[model samples]
Structures are given as C-alpha cells and as structure tokens.
Target: MHTPADSAVAIQGLHKKFKESHALCGVDLQVRQGEVLGLLGPNGAGKTTLVKILTTLLKPDSGHVLVNGWNVTADPEKIRSTIGMAGQYSTVDGLLTGFENLYLIAKLRGVGRRTARRNAEDLLARFRLSGVAGRPAGTYSGGMRRRLDLAAALVGSPPLVVLDEPTTGLDPESRLDTWDAVGELVAGGTTILLTTQYLEEADRLADRITVIDAGRVVADGTSDELKAAAGNRLVVCVAEDHQLDAAARAAARATGVTPMVDRRARRVEAAASDGPAALGRALTALEDEGVQVLEIGLSRSTLDDVFLGLTGRARHRAA
Candidate 1:
C-alpha cells in the first residue's frame, strides 16, 4: 500500500493558474524515499511553480501534495522544517564566511551554538570548503559559493533536499564538483528532488525522471527507459546547408516522424523505431532527392532525444 514512508514527495491532480494562463494542469509525480527525482521541463513549464508549491512559497490552485507524508496544505511548517532547498541563485549571506553561513543556519534551526559549529565544520569538510571556511562567501569563487549554498541547505540534515537548477551557471569543473556533492548526499540516503534543464544532469543523477511541458505531465521513467521509448535516432548530415530541407523531408519520410533540423550543422535527426529499415529508407530517399549525404547512421537515442520527442524542443544545456 502507498503510504507516507514510501514517497518523499507525492502530488495528485495538481493544478495552478496565474490569471488566464495555466501554470500547472492536473500534474502528478512522486519521488521515492532515498532516491533522486529529476523534474525536467522547458522554461515556463510549471517547474518553478511546482517548486514554489512544494517549498510552501506558493499555494496550488487545487491539488494534493504531500512531502514526507505530511499534506502541504495542512502542514507547511512541518514540511519546511524537514526539507532543505537550494535554488538556482545562492541564498547565503555574502557577509558571512563559509563556516558562518552554515553555522548560522544550524543555529536558526535550533541547534545549540556548539553543535552548530560542529555541523558547520563537518559540512565545510564534506564539500571541500574547509580550506576557505573563514573567507567571506562573497569573496569565494562561484563554485565555492555554490558549495557553501549547498552546505547551508543541509544545515539541519533535512531528509529531503530540493535542488532547483543547482548547477546552472557553473564552469564545467565546478559543475562536476556540485554533482559529486549531490552523489554524496544520495549515498548518505537523502531524498532529492532535482529540477534541471541540463539533460546530462538528469541523465546521470536521477533515479527516475518526470518530464512536464505546457503545464502537463508528459513522460516519466528511468533515463534508459525514456531513451528506449524514444527509439533510435536516424541522423543524416548533408554535405551542404542548402540540402537541409530535402534531408528533413527524407528523414520524415524514412521515420514517419518530423525531423529536427540543425542548419548550422547541416544535420537532420528523427526518431526511428525500426532502425535498419529506417536507415535503408533514408538512404533511398536521399538518393532520390539528389541530396548529398555526408553521413548517415542509426544511433541509440539519447536523453536529449527523448526530451525533444516529448516536448517538441531541445533543452538548452550549459557548457
């Protein structure tokens, strides 16, 4: 039987609106205990709105949301106390040093000063920020500040951590560091609700992913399952940009799915469920259309392919 202990987060028939525009439409998703749930959507896909509702910053128009088994409407305070949140923007005070940021948060959570100090030290070490633990957060590098922000979120050791675009603007190295920290959190049995537009993040971190677009739940599964459901990608690279249109038509004809056109790359991609047959058909269509094919292949579908197939657009990823 489904119960509070089984799901760290649960939503049923969720709906929300801002004036005439619908922000969420009967969306439902769940995060299993001690697992990471990646929430994926394009901008304005009700991700932020859902995060707000889960964090008790906004109330849903209608729906049942349970966090750690406590109803959102009946227990906002309980939910807040049990879940830690880190947004795209850092919430740490610039004036506070790394240790101070964590220490203060621990204190605010009602820990004794001595215990808060210990918690701060432990977190700084865990995130590899102990070397600059005394430096003001504003003076830290972007990555360090982000690490500190993450540390602050864990001050009270909340069972569930909601991370929204946690690595949005980090350098590749810094992003890796943040990802490592998240992995550590999971290893320690913390449940994570991660919302990110970075497809790679979802692919690597999420135990299960729930994709929403245009205010509705569109897809949900493990990364491999979503990719498998997207079938294979029939990719064609024409010799010239001018051939893109014909190539798109050929891919469409070959796969019976609309093709994604990349003019700059002189590439056309489409989902091909029948890999061998689709490749054969594409080759014929290209030859018939007098298109110069530089490369043609049927490759396994990627998470990005699954995302595009469901949402009708590519997710913009950070470098």
Candidate 2:
C-alpha cells in the first residue's frame, strides 16, 4: 500500500474524458519525494486535465491517483492540504499589495496573525518582492507578479508544489529568478511537479521528465537519457552563402546520412553517432573541398530534439 512516507505522487491506470474525447488513457506516473518531475507535452495533450485531477479540481473517469501518499479519490482533502499550486497565469489579486496577498493566504490557511505577517514578509524578501511589497500587484511588473504568485502558493508551506508553465511569459531574467526560486524550494525539501513548454526549463530543473502526446505518455526519463535516445548530431555553418551545398556534402559524407540544410541560416545539420569525431572529419572534408566554414559545433540531442524525434511535432512555437 502506498503511504505519505514514500512517494510524493503515484498514479496508475488513470483515465479522463471530455464528451467523446479521451484526455488521459491509462496514464501512470510516479514522483519521488523532494524531486522535481517535469511533465512535458504539446498543447491539448491532456496535461491540463491531469494537473486538474492531481489538484483535486477535477475527477478522473477511472484509475487511481495518490498524492503525498493520500489517494486523490478517497482522501482529496488530505492531498489538497499538502499541495501548493501555481498556475500558468498569475493568480495575484491586482488590487492588493504584494504583502497583503500573501498575508491573506497565510491567514486563510489558519496561521496566527503575527505568524501570518512574519511569513508574508519573509516570503516577499525571499522572492525579491520585498521592495515592492507595499505596491499594488496590478502596478507591479510582469516578473514581480509572477514572483508574487509563486510566493503566495507557498504561504502554507505545502510539501508538494504544482507549477504549470510558471515562466511561460516572462523575460529571460525573470525566468532565471523563477528557476532559482524553484531550486531553493527543492533545497528546502519540497517536491515539485512542473509542467512547461520550455524544454530548456525542464532540462535545467527536472530530475526526471515525463512526456505525453495525444493524451498518452510517449517517453519518460532523465534529460540525458532522453537526449541519448534522440541521438547526436553535427551542426555546421558555412562562412560564404555559396558554400552551403559544399558544407552539406561534407556533412553527409562524414555522417553517412543526407544532411539537412537551412539556407536562411547558412547551416547544415546531420545525425552522427560519434559526435565530435564526426564533426572533426566533416570539417576536414569541408576544408579539403575549399568550403570556407564560418562556424561549426557538435551537440548532443536536446530535449527539443527528443520531442521532435518522438512526436514528430514542435513542442513550442516562436513566441
């Protein structure tokens, strides 16, 4: 029997549906205590539905979900009590000051008035929102709002935090700040279930990743494991625009596969098992053929590459 002392989250044969469309099909997942698990999928891939079920906002059609070792179906309140949620959009109250928002949540969670004030102040400082704690959340910048939303979720100090695309619309600086915050949360022994569109984010934060497509799990593994499954490749960029075809020929010859060319980027890419060695040979071949190369690099397959290789579709659009 599963217990709160073991896994943070455990699911088996989970299924959910909307009208005739099935959202989850026998989905099973496990999140180790104090580990960050990245849940990845394209839009409309049942990610939202599954998160809802875990948060006790929606009921699954069938199967079992245990959160913090409490069955989601049988002891929803117990599960809910241990979970903190930060959704895709900011849930901060626009009219309320940052400190007020967190203070309110603390009080609502049954904290004493003095303790609530202390917690709110501490969270504001921790999230780098102390400077803006007196400002109305509506008047805050995008990054500030996101930080406030995240801080608010931790008011009760829940053991499991569910972050749904927490950095979706933030600037690079803000995203990094959020990443640091997540790291701190984990360092403090909090487990996180993160769903995100940014492969880089998952690659950085997750100890393990679970990928779903069309409402079904397509892959699950560590970032390196997933990348290895996608395979390694060489990327070569020619100096002169006219040298593109020559570079492509070199890449193909070195890798024993037809190289893909991007004319706009003046680049040629091809899969290579030997990575650096293949890239070295490809460069030598290009040099011998008098193809002036501007730049070249060998890269292992990335999470984006893994998603493309598995789902045959781009996960994130240019935004």
Candidate 3:
C-alpha cells in the first residue's frame, strides 16, 4: 500500500563515475506514486545508470535515493523487495519452459509451492503465453520472450517496476501488445519508471518525461511540454534533386532562418513560429523562383527535436 504523498522514487544530486566517464552528474528526479515517468536519453546518457541506482543494483558515489520513503543506501534489502526490474535483455532461462521460469521467480519471491504454480500459470495465461508454457524458452520468438520476461518481473507483485528499454527489439505488433500490458499494470496502481530511446513510446506511455544528455538532465516535463520548449513548428519540403539549394534558400528567406538541407533526400527543413503559414509562403516563393516543389508539410515538434536542440545531435543512430 502506497500513500499519495509518498513518492515512488526520489533522487537528489546523484553522481556516478566509471574510469574517466561520468555516467551521472548531479542528477535529480522524482516519480510520484502510481505515475509512469519516462527517462529519455541517447546512448551513454546515464538513463540505465539511474535505473540501476534506483533499483538498488548499483550505488551512486554521492547523493541520495529514496524509494517508497526508504533510503536506497540504508535500506537496500527492503528496497529490493519492493522493486521489480526488467532490463533490455530477457532473463528467461533457455533450457527451462516458460512456466518453469515463472515458477522459479514466484518461489524466489516467497510464494508457497502450490501458490507459485498457480501464480505462474495465471501469469502465463494473462500474458497469452499459456499456449507455449511447456515449450523451452529458447524456442520462443523475440516478442514471446519479452512477454515472458515482463511476466517474470511481476511474480513478486512489487509496488514499483523499472523497465529499461523493455520494447527495444519487438516488432510493431509486439510493441503494441507490450504497451497494453504496461497500461494494464499502471491501471492497477503500480508505479513504473521506464527508460527508452523510442520517442513514440515515451509519448504514448509516460505521464511525465525527463530528458538527459551528457549525463545531466537537460529537460523535464510532459511530452507536449518538452516539445513546446523545443521551440516551434517544423516545415519540411522536398524539391527536385537539382533544385535543392534554391529551395533551401527560398525556405530560409521565407522563415527568416537558414534551412537545413539534406542533399541526398532533396529536402529542406526549417523551423518557424507558424509552420503552416511559413510553409505556404516558402512554397509560393519557390514556385515564383521556378523551383518545382515535390511535397511540403508542417510537422509538430517532437521529443526527437527536443533532443537535437539540447544535445546538438539526434538521440538515435541515423536511420
């Protein structure tokens, strides 16, 4: 049972270092009870390190972490008991059946033998893995294994669950199924702290988001709030391959900011306060200059835009 006022997780001035790399630098965050907080950052941005610290798997060199009002350092054992974690890799044993894997976790969580069996079976059915419960986990597809891993995390019925890139390798359908499961857990009043590189996933699942770059928090807010802070609308236009430079110039003149040109894509992208009107002006200007427009549209600012603005780089590898 968690009180509304009791924060699910709280960290203050958290710092960690490995060799010369500063993994976390003066990081501070809080996740309210029953809320889903998304941690977004590029690789080497300290998202996983923060999750590890909160889950009591690693200790910060300085600062404090409190989970359910218990200090992580002073009450590590208690914190571990209250928290469940599923990392990027599935932890299901390849040699064991899905049911056996879940059964082992239930027993480890102190459930009686009969209860463990019942719990394992129920979880398998709930995750829609009962059909393959007897099959060795090694034979499971990527999506099935991910579902099993998530199911195992719930064996303890922990109040808080930390998911670090839980949907990294799943197909679109699998990701949607996983999202539904997460929603169901949240609806049941479980607090979740999710770390992911997928902006769309964060937008879909998080109540609040914290964006970290170079080991420090660069932004924190809801998805819409962060996007608003990133500035304004973006207008993208594709032109004939040979006319890209002229189109870029036209866009710059219309928007009063130099547009970014992607020669390979024959596209020019620029930001503007009023995207639709700006795009229309740019298009008209381009046509006046004898430049043929292929396509044009105004796009809402996204978390990716926020990351690029703050970090001076894209959050993920270029597609």
Give the number of the best model, judged by TM-score. 1
> What TM-score goes with each of the models?
0.89, 0.87, 0.87
Q: What's model 1's TM-score?
A: 0.89
Q: Mind giving the per-residue lDDT tens digits that candidate 2 earns over 60-99? A: 8999899987888899998878899998778889999999
Q: Flag clash pairs in model 2.
A: none
Alpha carbon lDDT of each predicted model: 0.90, 0.88, 0.85
Instruction: State in Å the error of residue 101, model 2.
Output: 1.4
Cand. 3 Cα-lDDT: 0.85
Order the candidates by lDDT, highest first.
1, 2, 3
Worst 10 residues of 2 by lDDT: 310-319
Model 3, 1-319: lDDT tens digits are 2342578888889999998999999998989988999998888889888988888889889997888788888999998888888887888899999999999988888889999999999889988999999999999988888889888888868899899998887888888989988887888788999998888889999999998887899889999998877666545456567788788888887789878888888878887767667877887888776787777777767787777887888768412
For model 1, residues 1-319, the per-residue Cα lDDT tens digits are 2577899998999999999989999999899998999998887888888998999989988999999989999999999999999986899999988988899899899999899999999999999999999989999988888888888888889999999888888999889989999998989899999998888999989999999998999999999899888888899999988889999998999999898898888899888999999999999999999999999998999988788789888887655
Leading candidate by lDDT: 1
Off by over 4 Å in 3: 1-4, 234-243, 262-267, 273-298, 317-319
